[model samples]
Target chain A: MGIIVLKGYMIFTIVLMIVYAVRHLLFAYNRAFGKQKLYYNDIYSSRMPKISVLVPMHNEEQVLHYVLDSLLQCDYDRDRLEIIPINDNSTDRTRELLDEYHAKYEFIRPLHRDCPDRGKPAGLNDAMAVATGDIIIVFDADYRPATDMLKQLAIAFADPSVGAVMGRVIPYNANRNMLTRLINLERSGGYQVDQQARYNMGLIPQYGGTVGGFRKDLLLKMGGFNPAVLAEDTELTFRLFTNGWKVIYANSAECYEETPETWEVRGRQIRRWSRGHNNVMFRYFLRVLVTKHMNWKEKLDGILLLLVYAVPFLLAVGQLDAIALFFLHEMDILSGWWVLLFIGAYCSFGNFAPFYEIGSALTMDGIKNEVYLLPLIMYNFYFYMWTISLGFLDAIADLITGRQVVWAKTKRFTK
Target chain B: MASDHKRQIYFARTYRHLKANRAECALFLLLFILPCLVLLLLFYDELTWVMTNGAVWMIQQAGGPRAEISAGTFLPRLGPAYYAVLPTTQPDYSLILGNLAVCLGTVWVLSTGPRKGRPVAVYLSIMLLIHTMACAFFLLGKDLMPYTLEDFSDLYIKQQIGIWITFLVLIGLVMGVLGRGAILRRMLTVVSIMLYSFVLGFVRYVLFLWILYRFSVLYMPLMFFALGPFFDFLYFVAIYAISTNGVIRIYNTKKKGDWVWA
Candidate 1:
């Protein structure tokens, strides 16, 4: 009976590993073999879509100026562009910063919210009520987009089916610390390889909240961003996909973001992400599987992607099974032929290890020297598994107890 | 039209030359020959010992329900040792032949590629093919004792682990090959193979197999059920796809003339 339970655990672990590995492997394969439809130079020659750039902020005085300055320098038509920097009851100089920018540029429209409602989704919803542009682009205060970034993101709207467009985010202060460096690696793999691969393969390329835009009408039609969900981006992505809309990954539309510079900050950020993503997983795992519009490949990729944040928790549980087996003197079940399987599992898991993904990403970017840092990701993996596993547990508890989720802001270091 | 004909004639000549080339033929043969030698060298002593004097512990270690061994089977007198009792079960003949076909087929597919293609892809694929076959040989031989005794062993387990390790290595290599620069790609290829091989060695045979199984299962679903019940028929298909397409990517690349075929 104990042996059967061990076998069950082994089966579960094996299936999870295969699913995740197949997902990443397919991404890698598509990035190699598939034809890229979205290119930076493939600019739309049609009429430019009117874009309302929404900056949702809460006491973001330190970094707001950088984004404002960058927005002012954007190589977009002033008549068609509108910038609405929302100040969600900030006690700091955020309102002053917005007013100053508003006074200088006609496109800069400051929206100061004095109401009790806060958080990014609420701010976005408030701005959506007043935004006049055909498309709405969202950016956190820390992002410094390129001059033509808006142009690149906006052009994708020319394709009627493209309901949303996502731009790649690179970290400016990556060299500041080890935490930032690791974040940089993660971003590169996430955007350069994973997102691009999904886009190329006709799979879902996620619409990240920041540095991405969606049709204003579409969001308004769907009742704006869900304020209840911490990961409005993931929620929006699934909503759009389920409704038969496409989200494109604009890889060359690179914007700079200030990554969390400390381990504590990074941990908080990942925990928030894990919780939010798992929440979406709970909501969309079956939805993606049951959706009729998506082919088997898209459904497969989407479902695996939804459960990605939860995999670490599964791995942790499997590790427990291994330990129990060891202590229970039932390890003899792993003898002979089972031994090869154990080695294969290790290799399979190692292939999807962030080390390999980051190395591959770095190699693609022509930065060969950074590949040396790949081995360090083992530590990063363990750290994430430990923290995110806890986040997974918290998500489950929240689901069970019907607990209200809080938005934990990731503490940023401007430098 | 004349130029096309000439090109076609040139390709035919190249194909003929490739097939008859003593070096290529020898390399093809080596894929089978080397594995056999490695297996013999790895397990000849233990196998000979087991054949001459049946391991009492092996029979005892058969903790699960024991099955019958035909009196006239090939288990006891392994290759006419003429030393011990003529009793016990024999390894499944189909399992041995199937594994042999897979190893040889993998080598054949990897070795033969487009005459003109990326050198990096060819070199990397070759390394994976050779290393994988070598590991398969070692792992297969390591399980020979249990297989011969039919001692609560499953050949499907051995094959799955071997094939998955090879697939993982190939996938990593493909990622590396798609990377920028010949030097970096080559470095990554060697480094990846070495790192994976080292990890495989660190855990030894039995532990390594299970760990391999664990990771494969962790990354995928329906692995045990699909590959287990189907007896690895689909696994062979995947291996074929990975090896064939991996090499063909080099052929398909625009910058194909850079690397010489290995």
Candidate 2:
């Protein structure tokens, strides 16, 4: 009777798993259905939407030029666009470059900060006080979008329900070394397929901190941001979703960013992100799921994403249980070929699905770009520490202890 | 002025107290080092078994690259098998002591077992996911067995069909409950279905599967939360399922979708 119940439960679980996997596959199909890109020139009409592009910087002298050059070459509506480069407490040539660009580019406007540290959100809020545009686009110093990004983003907003749109961020110098190669693979699974999958299915996804756009009205409605947390982007996203607003994502709106050259730098950036994410989760955990007007599904998704940091530890435990069972139950588990097949089936499904989806989403022609470390991508087991531990621990501390977190900057690099 | 000098004298007393604490800082090594040594000894044979095969045995036995550590906590290579791959890298009492000291210090910082700082935790968790993914990406996505890149397009399609069903159920339930106001209720049904579909798609598809996998639905819920951080795809499905009103039919249901090439 005991064996029968166990096996019966296994059958039930397997059936449920398949049913669930099928559901997600179908959602992705609809998102991809009949969606094709419009070429830059053909889609980019001369009637440019006046965009207020904000670059809030603390000490971003390194990559300001790269961003400026990319902005100058935008595919649509550049004439009506006003570039406000907000220099937040930078005692460097960052200001000089901003001035040089302002001198050369008529659309460039520079603002300097003269206050004690308030952080990135405060910098953005200050800039928003003076911004003038129908559309607001935010970019980090390290990223440079494709020429057609503005045009593509504008077109995506044609749908009235879309409150914001997120663009794709690809590693600009992916081939830098082994570390970057692993990073490229991880990023692909993260932003490309994961974000796109959510958008296609109509779930509210956290915006990419860089490469996102907002309506001026909605921006004001959200009141800039709650500077109390490290990650303001995540906070604003949930707030916007509960208000019956939708965010759109365009995979073709390509932008490139520099991966931290080494793990040490990556570690610092992740620590700040972890702290910020923890703050966001605490502030919004139950609020987004149960109390918010959104259904159980979206809230569950939000909670799960915040809690997803805990999955690795759980899987490690599961692996132990499996190993224990091998010793305690199956002396030689190879006794059944069926077991091997079952393991193969789920393992294959778990591992491979994201790569193809992300790879295809990134390329215009749908050809996969081979980041050579593809084989060693698995070695990153040592690479993603901060995101899980710091993100999870910090989140928990903030929630339990009610300790507030402040924004920490990701030191930018230029090529 | 008298208080300032008195305060300086108080500070001088505290500096000695801190120096005394600093002398005991090296003792922190015992916490992590002791466990590592005990674990090393406990799994000695397994370590030997791995070492005999030159750690190839460890890689194979753990079932792949991601299993270097037994249950992902104690990196077993640091165990008895430490000498097999790099025999010259002898395990010294001091080195073991050092490893333990660093582990203890970090774990102390990490709190219970080095609180696994966010950097170490996220990076390690992501690495494990990538490792699992490297093992499966090709086999599932492109339909290439034993490779990277999988096509989860099916997962998305079926999610849509599930959404459609959920909305039908939700609308029927609401109509049955509030039949008096026909126009207002009808408007709500349409709006609710549209809004709820996203949440429904996410719940049914993503979170459900996550629960199934985490608890091993077959066994117990031992420490599955570790996989929680790496379960990005699972989270995506939950959001997709919950927010969707209906699920799309990726396959005709009449045929085996897995066998068909996209």
Segments in model 2 whose C-alpha atoms lie over 4 Å from true places: A1-47, A76-79, A291-297, A313-372, A385-387, A401-404, B1-262
The per-model DockQ list reads 0.04, 0.03
lDDT of 2 by residue, B178-240 (tens): 111223433444455444543443333333333323322211111121332123223332332
Off by over 4 Å in 1: A334-354, B1-262
Best by DockQ: 1
Candidate 1 local Cα displacement, residue A187, angstroms: 1.5
TM-score of each model's B chain? 0.26, 0.22
For model 2 the local lDDT of residue A309 reads 42
lDDT tens per residue, model 1, A1-415: 8779886886677767756665666665445434445554466665788999999888888899999899888888889999999998889889997898888887789899998667788889999999999999988989999898889889888889988889889999989977677677778778777888788778889999999999999899999887767789998898889888988888878899999876656667777888888988888888888888788877877887787788878876765565455334343353323434543443344423433444445534534344444444544544676568777887887789877776656665784
CA shift of B140, model 2, Å? 46
